[model samples]
Target: MKASKSIVRRTRWPDSAGAPLVTPLQPSVVYASSSPDALDAQYDGTAPGYTYAREGHPNADVLARKIDALEGAEAGLVTGSGMAAVTAVLYGLPGQGDHVLAGNQLYGRSMRMLREELPRMGIATDMADPTDAAAMAAALRPETRLILLEVVSNPTLRVSDIAGIAALARERGILLAVDNTFTTPRGLRPFDHDADIVIHSVTKLLAGHSDATLGYVAARDPEHRKRLYETAVTLGLTPSPFDCWLAERGLQSFELRYDRAEANARALADALADTPGVRRVLYPTRPDHPDHDRAVSLLGDRGGPMVCFEIDGGRAAANALVEAAPDIAFAPTLGDIGTTLSHPASSSHRGLAPETRAALGMTEGVFRVSLGIEDADLLISEFRAAIAAATAG
Candidate 1:
């Protein structure tokens, strides 16, 4: 009652009882309780409240629950970025001397984490061809505790046999973690195939736009979820409330965006296959793709929201095409509402040795195109013209 005028105005809190049609942003770092007992209950996880944003928050809980529903997961946690999601699972599950078996085909950052970072902590990792069940089995060690995979590997568009790999992991008591970033739940729910853990870069298809930088980790078991949460909090990987709110808005039109992008992807792949100077077009359903049969069996008719192609003249031709396509942004990211192009050699896989990149089929000529909801015909024309421009004398 005796406080200054500024303090009185700043301390005023909204007391409205009406509900909003959308999820509201709760950015408060700390929360208050009616009593010490109530605060203690919240801290002990017995009460339904968040005492700290870094530990947990309303926005993250809402988004995580939505992801759980989408992925058919029992529980989920949201983190700051896609790599953070991977980090939470890796650090949360395995301890020193434990081995991790990862698919040879993976995002560059993920590969780096396994090959470079995990080893620093005394955890060992081995790369195996996930498409070949025999190779994966052979790579497994008695100390192997986790098998990391991507439903559809980034850039290259290789589709893994989720059911087969899940079976292998289950038989061996290994926890299988699949990144569904490339093929969101709309395209494939890894959990349906018995995958123990599901991960997502919510910045991609789930959000349907490039506005949010968030990641998600989901699991069927309560203990796994608890461990992930604890690891994420301990590492300060908590997501921003604003980003979580943004992602929730994006989720409202996720399926719509995904369907349109996938259509564009298929159309673009078909068009590019017939164009000159295009050495090869890599799409999951395409007969030319290495994993064509597996893709068809696993994804049904969905080819996902990406298409890749090889230029005839390596980096020069790739650069020419990028420069010619003024309409399509040449960005180093994916899963946006508008089409974008990324050259892996100079971006994603740039850190790897040249020989290693070649072994993985990520040559200088490869162009990873993320399709959008734009007019398919328009994109086809633009790409053809751009390719012609790149190849022109």
Candidate 2:
């Protein structure tokens, strides 16, 4: 039966002491069974009994189930971190001579994983512009089996043609894996567009408190799910039971938090579009955005809580503003509950060469604003004063 999106998020595993108002954390590493048939089911992966923490845990299982329903996936696997999730998929799927086509606009670690780490394992990766369907199509080769892209990329806020890319991938018998961290399942869902896998850094958004460093990869095929699960076990990159429980607890308020953040982001995008030291605003809701049309069709009205822009004087100006900003603090990551800002040049995209970063629109002047549940007018007024003061300094 199809799960209702409204109620599925609120669903949780019933507790031993009967139903509680909220789900409690389960940290047991292993389970013991008295029935021999139940033991057999655990050995064959049929039953729900968790034998070891490395394989699975109750909290992690609950988190995975929620992610599966949220992502509209057949199954979901939770991992220690976002990079772990990415590694599990890349490590499991490709081998010697297999090629992966990835977008150049990925997060620095993800780019490093594909360009540096994956090659170490004998797999080849090609970087391409995910926004360009024709370019991605031309880059596909016989050995190209997986395509990697991020929905609403970080820092520069680039949006891709998911359904178009997925269609092209499907036509070529290739798999398309989308990193849904920036937009989350609330803002956009790749599965609805026929994407093979949806990857997320649950640490950033789903956890909300910036406490849990975890990730999840959702796949609609059972066979692909088996491979991911096996890879996760072998890699020893399983998410902790406490983090999983926290993530599950955080999932309950996702709708409320996401909606408020998106609204705040929309306001900030408009206010920062023509700020004294700002060159341009890159939010999906803005009509002037290059990918605005695509975002509307694929992501609907809410385009996540990220509003990125370029400053007037490049790196120096960005540093001045970021350093002197009073109302905002310098945070390296996004999707947290507090209003925070990050400069990609020194943080997320610092690993990329200057030329490469420029090519991907992630310049030194580029900074991203992750709107929280704070009052929009208050944030706007304070940020405007901060920008003015920074420019003066």
Candidate 3:
């Protein structure tokens, strides 16, 4: 019965009848009812049926079931975008006067939502350094109902203390919601460490392609799952059936894609360490990384697909990489099929003021790379040459 978890996630769903090895996409908006009473029961949650596309679509439902299996969750829900999934959880879990404690370094949009939208709705919000458990604990309040963090933060790739944070949440009766985007189930399942909720941007490594914009929420608590589903419906955040199908198809190759890319990223991180024109290389797998031991403990032997580094000279050298390297690409998003470079200062962290970003360790020269399945040697050669040319006078 023991096999690779990836194989289990892929094979858990039975093949559609008359269609071998493929899942049929159901794009219907409404389903015919056998009787009026049956429809009423379904509407009342006393029967099994889907009434509307916005409420529930077959393709999305199937994908959600698959996600539930993958994340070992009590339930899973899909949304149109990563932020939609996150926002649904935030909105559903908190009441008008509830409190939320979040990590200071999060995706720019996520940070903005907590700081702006939550307060507008009369919810109290607090931010703390995720790497410091004491700081997170100190920031908690009696009214704190939820604690949000990204396991591997945006751009900078700082690994949070998941077990520590989860423990704190348990002791305080607060729900710990972890964004498992950078580190998927393959990298590490946050729920295994007692995370109450796990959020993933399926548009990234789970889909393994840049085409689909999707996200998923996996909750360990059944009540939380029901609340999330209701909130998603109320907000009209359900994904289209077509996008759900594409994301479902993308999941088949995810394990293979994630492992290859993660290995290449670790290789690149190793090769770039202490290279000429390199000031700092931040990858949790590296022995010298501040969170290396924690990552190893939490993630086992797995690593993420992204690596972050800073080259010499300030913004000029960072810009030179784009100007001098024609082969490399500069994309704001991570976890694509191709190796792409991104500058966090101007992209992910631009929402923050200059001083605020620096205080979070996202410097002007910082660049992150989401490594693809390309040959590690070829990428090393290309980046080595580009780094030298960019830093040259």
Q: Tens-digit lDDT track for model 1 on 307-354?
A: 999887877888899999999999989999999999999998898898
lDDT tens digits, residue span 1-393, model 3? 766457443233466456546777777777777799999999998998798888888888788888778788766888989999999989989989899999998989999999999999999999998988999999999999999999988878888988788889989999999999998888888888899889988888888778888889978878888999999999999798888888889888888888899899989998999579888899987888889899888787686889999887888888887787677778888888889889888887788988998888788888889999999999888888889988996
Query: All models: lDDT?
Result: 0.90, 0.85, 0.87
Give one clash count per candidate, in the order shown: 0, 0, 0
Instruction: Return the TM-score for each candidate structure.
Output: 0.97, 0.93, 0.93
Off by over 4 Å in 1: 1-12
Candidate No. with top lDDT: 1
Candidate 2 clashing pairs, residues 3+ apart or interchain: none
- After TM-score superposition, the amount by which residue 15's alpha carbon in candidate 2 deviates from its true location, in angstroms, is 11
Model 2, range 325-361, lDDT digits (tens) per residue? 7668688988788888998889988888899888878
Q: Write the candidate numbers in order of decreasing TM-score.
A: 1, 3, 2
lDDT of 3 at 51: 89
Instruction: Compare candidates 1 and 3 on TM-score and give the better one.
Output: 1
Best by TM-score: 1
What's model 1's lDDT at 242?
96
